[model samples]
Each structure stands twice: as structure tokens, then as C-alpha cells.
Target: PKSTPAPDRHRPSSAPPAAPAAARVLWKRGDTGRDVRELQARLRQVEWLVDGPTGTYDDLTERAVSGFQGKRGLPRTGRTDTVTWQRLLGMSHEPGKWDLYLMGGQPAAAPDLRCTSGRVLCVSKSSRTLRWMIDGRTVSTMSVRFGSQYTPTREGVFQVYWKSRHHVSTLYDSAMPYAMFFSGGQAVHYSYDFAARGYAGASHGCVNVRDEAAIADLYAQVKTGD
Candidate 1:
């Protein structure tokens, strides 16, 4: 579970969907993932859309894509081709969890069975909430943001293997404070981006906690293992 550079999942470490490559990845209507979410975010930034960034490329997203393409003199395919993505990227910036979930819908997945007993960091995706539970009793709860659709936070039970009070990402040089590593590069950490943007941005693969004080408390309570 310990890591240096390989485990860090910062978006900059890998090419964004809009990055140039020989084989292009196109996002069309019905496609669902972080890429699509990003496309919608960009459309919203350029004022071509104000509907849903539901992480799904629905008809509204399609129309937005087409409209953007047409405005930029590209083909109105309603598909986010590489050229279109690149163009949009030039016009807009990346989005966060709150930005993607602009309407502020909570996640819907329940905690794993492992969380019911023993000390556990209960993360419920369905409600986008994390519960710090000790012996099946809830100690504290806070809103959380997992990774983006592209690099999703993992599921299943994992123990905290390491902890760092202050960690800076090797690849992206982003600061991750109070990081409690449960999986390789992925940890429950305090993200400045999450705090600043709210849900407007997302994590690479880490569980991002916005409340610094809350995460500091949780970090103190959570040891290397239960």
C-alpha cells in the first residue's frame, strides 16, 4: 500500500481525454465516465450548456457538444472528437467534483459489509458521505469526493497501511495533507482543490476530504491499521 510516484493518480500524470495522441478517444451521447463529465464541464464553462453534468453524455450533453463544435467551426457531430476536445480545453479549464455534480446530487452506493463491525472508515458512495465508525458506532461523518470517472476510487475493504501528515505528489506536485494510505497511491487526504471548488472538481483516485480540521481529527484517530 505504500508508494512513491507510481501510485499517485493525479490527472496530469496521465494525458487528459483532450490530450493529443494518435488514437483518439471520442465521447458521444450515452457514454459515461470522467471524460464525458469533463466535456460537459467545459461546455458549461463556455456557456454552451447549463443542464446536467450527470457524468453521462445524455442528449443535452450531445447538443452542447454539437453546438460547441459548430461555434468553433468544427463538424457538428454531437460527438466530442479529439479536435473538439482540444478546442474546448483551450477555452475552459478542468472541473472538480462539485463542478461535475453541479446540481449537487449525492452518490448512491452503500458502505461495504466490512464497515458494520470493527473500526472502519465507512465510505458510502450513494450519499457521498464518509462515516468514521468505531465498533459499529459512528464517531463522525463528513461529505467526501472520490476519484473522477477516469480514475475512480477503489471499492472493497482495505486497511490503512501508511500515514503522512504532509505529502506532495511526485508527478503533479500537488499537496496532499493528512494522507492515510489504504491503497497504493490512493489515500484519504485533505485536498485544497476539493475545499476551494467544492464538487466542481474531482480527485485522481484518492478520497478527498475538504474539511481540513475534520480530516486532521480523523487522521489522528486512524492509525496504520485497526
Candidate 2:
């Protein structure tokens, strides 16, 4: 009888992180392929990478993935395994509520949304709350989870860059990233399932609201700096 050949040390170019064979190969040092390209595109959406086309896992991609891994409190192996690959693809297994903790309570004072013309409204993931101002009056309120720790909304001052009533996603099942980018890959949009815990926190760092009215209101009133 002939013995079976050894599994390919190299990973295929199109395997998802959840594939059973993902554990058999090292993806970082491996050559680039369609799989790597997919990863590049997804990473770009979340602002984890700035360069590298969809194809190979080049040095730049490796570095970017490494940095991401480090930031996520994972091993800095740089090699793409099932766990790392899942995160890169935004398909990470849900971490239960116990895994997450809030060190500080919600902001003691509400956020100031008044005259936010030239300022950005930042939401604290740690606090699961949002702060904005209008007419010099502060409005600090709790917000639903739009993404998970793995695919969190970015932090920065972004303009109301774009708007859309009907959006689509190639990776996810629904449309999001609707309007306004506030920095660090975060956005404000519409979705009603924000209360579902881990399952609801699946956006690619985009803030999801409760309905069309909310998004519409934001889209019309918000300006480049507001």
C-alpha cells in the first residue's frame, strides 16, 4: 500500500480562516495568492493596511498583520493561522461578555455636542457610550455595539465624508458604513440588532443606529466638520 502524501506546508490562496486545513500551513511566509488578496482588501476596509494589492503576503502585509495581532493581544507570530486568519478576515469567533470589561463607568458628564462644527465626536469603546454637543449643550449617551474588539471602529476626527441610503457588503450579509467617518475606521449608520451582544457587534467598525430615520437625520444635519 502507498502512504498518503504529507499535507502541503504552504497554505492555499483561497482558504477561509475557518477551514479545517488552516492549521496545516504557515500563511505569513507563504507566497501570495487570491486568499492573501482577500485578506488585504478586508484589512484595508478597516484601515489596517494602506498598501499591497490582493495577491501575496509580502513583507508589508506581514508587518501590517503583525501589528494588528500585537494590538489585539494575540501572539506576535506573524504567521497566519486559524485564529489570526479569522481576525484578519473579520470572522473571529465571538468572545463572550466575560472576556470584555469596562474599567471606567460612563462619562460622569454628558458630551458636549454644541458647536461641534470643527470637532469630531468620539465614542469610547471601553465605555460603550457616545458624546456629542449641539448649541453648547452636551449630550452623552450610551450607544449600541457596532463592532467587536477584533474589528473595532477606528479613532480619529473624520468628516461627513460620504452618505448612502442603500449600501452593500461583499463580506457581510447586510449594508452598513452608511454615512460619516469619524476616524479610525468608524462610521454611523442604521441597524436595529445592536442589542444582541456579540452577534450584533459584527460591523467592520461602523456605528450602527436603530433605523433609517436616525441615519437620515444624521446625514442631513451633519456637515464636513460637524
Candidate 3:
């Protein structure tokens, strides 16, 4: 009786436990929060996903996340866990290669432009080039793609009529309209895919450039007739 089974030596202790586990990131599928928003942004940056203004997890985002995960040899859970988030943000062991901001880096400004009021708007649809005149001298000349015969870019004097940080086009949304739309509905816009000079040419009826800021700077240097 005094031994009393040694006070149950094999009994387990319950001392209020250890720290709680971290929360898992839920991507576009039953998730609606800031983390999902970040995931969408990162995915879009890498061209793995399309435009979505909402953070609620949807089927499109789920598919994109799965595709991205498969491409990276991840688990393909379609959920943005810590590992997925890290990979998406370029912080994982195998980071995403594409840099979205690289679109802002243009090769160079047009070198030869004629100085004149309307010369800045001279974009040749046939040659796929643009020419600008300043002070009666050619100041800028560069390769460009004008609209096709079906939707030709209007040939005339256009100004920096409208600037939009998030302009939506008929085919796509979230366009950056740099120089104005002098033609019917066409405008000089920033095209991320235009980084490769003359390699590709596709536009409804507008001029597409690499860097928006560069075009903006060029536009700023000009006047109505300077």
C-alpha cells in the first residue's frame, strides 16, 4: 500500500502546451485577405496570373497558382503557403526569374527628331517607326508599331492629352496611357512585352512603347510649337 504503484510514473504532463502553429496562406479559393492579395499581385507580376482587383479566392487564381506551382515543381496545392509565397516573391530557394519592373527599362530614346509642332505625332504605319521634330530639327527617331490596315493609327498631331495610371482597353485592363489619344480611340501606351525591339507588333490602333516614364519625359520636353 505504501508503494501505491509509484504514483503512476508513466503519466503524461499537460503544462499548457507550446507555441501555436503559424497560419497557412490561403490563395484564390476560399481565401479573402491581404495575403491572398499579395499572392495575386506576385503571380500577376510573373505573368502567371491575370488581372483581378479582388482578393477573394476564385477559380481563376486557383488555376494560376496550381500552374505556377507545377512549373516550379512545387506541391501544386494551389494554395499560397509560406513556401509558395516565398517562391512567388523571389525569396525562396528557386525564385521566380521574371522581373516585372524590368518592363520599365527601355533600350533608348529616339535619337533623331525634327523640331516642329506636329512632328512628334508622326508615326509611320508602314515602316513601323516613329519620328519627332523639335525646334525645326529631327530629335527623336525609333522603331515602333502602328495599327494595322484594319485599325490604322490615325496620322495627325496628337498631344499628351490624357494620362492614366490605370487605363482599360477593349482587350485588356490596367493600361498606362502615356501620350494622349489623338486618333479615334488609340493612344501611346506602355507595353511590357515591347521590351524586345521589333520582335513583336500587335495593337488595335495605338502606339506601344516599353517605358511609360521615358515617353512621358519626351512628351514633357515638347510644347504646342516649341
Each prediction's Cα lDDT score?
A: 0.82, 0.56, 0.58
Predicted model with the maximum TM-score: 1
lDDT string, candidate 3, 1-226, tens digits = 4755566667777676788676476454787765555566577667776653245678888888889889988878887777677777683232121122222212334433432444455555444555556444556655455566787767654565555545777665546455455555777766655644332346677787655566666566645332
Residue 226, model 1: lDDT of 58
lDDT of 1 by residue, 11-130 (tens): 455544665555255887779887777788778899998765768989898888888878888778888878888888899987866677654445545556788788899987767888
lDDT by residue (tens digit), candidate 2, 41-92? 5565566766534366877778777878798887777666677777665643
TM-score list, all predictions: 0.54, 0.41, 0.40
User: If both were scored by TM-score, which would come out higher, candidate 1 or candidate 3?
Assistant: 1
Off by more than 4 A, model 1:
1-112
TM-score of 2: 0.41
Q: What is the lDDT of residue 122 in candidate 2?
A: 47
Task: Let me know the TM-score candidate 1 reaches against the reference structure.
Answer: 0.54
Estimate the Cα RMSD of every predicted model relative to the unseen true structure: 22.0, 19.2, 12.4
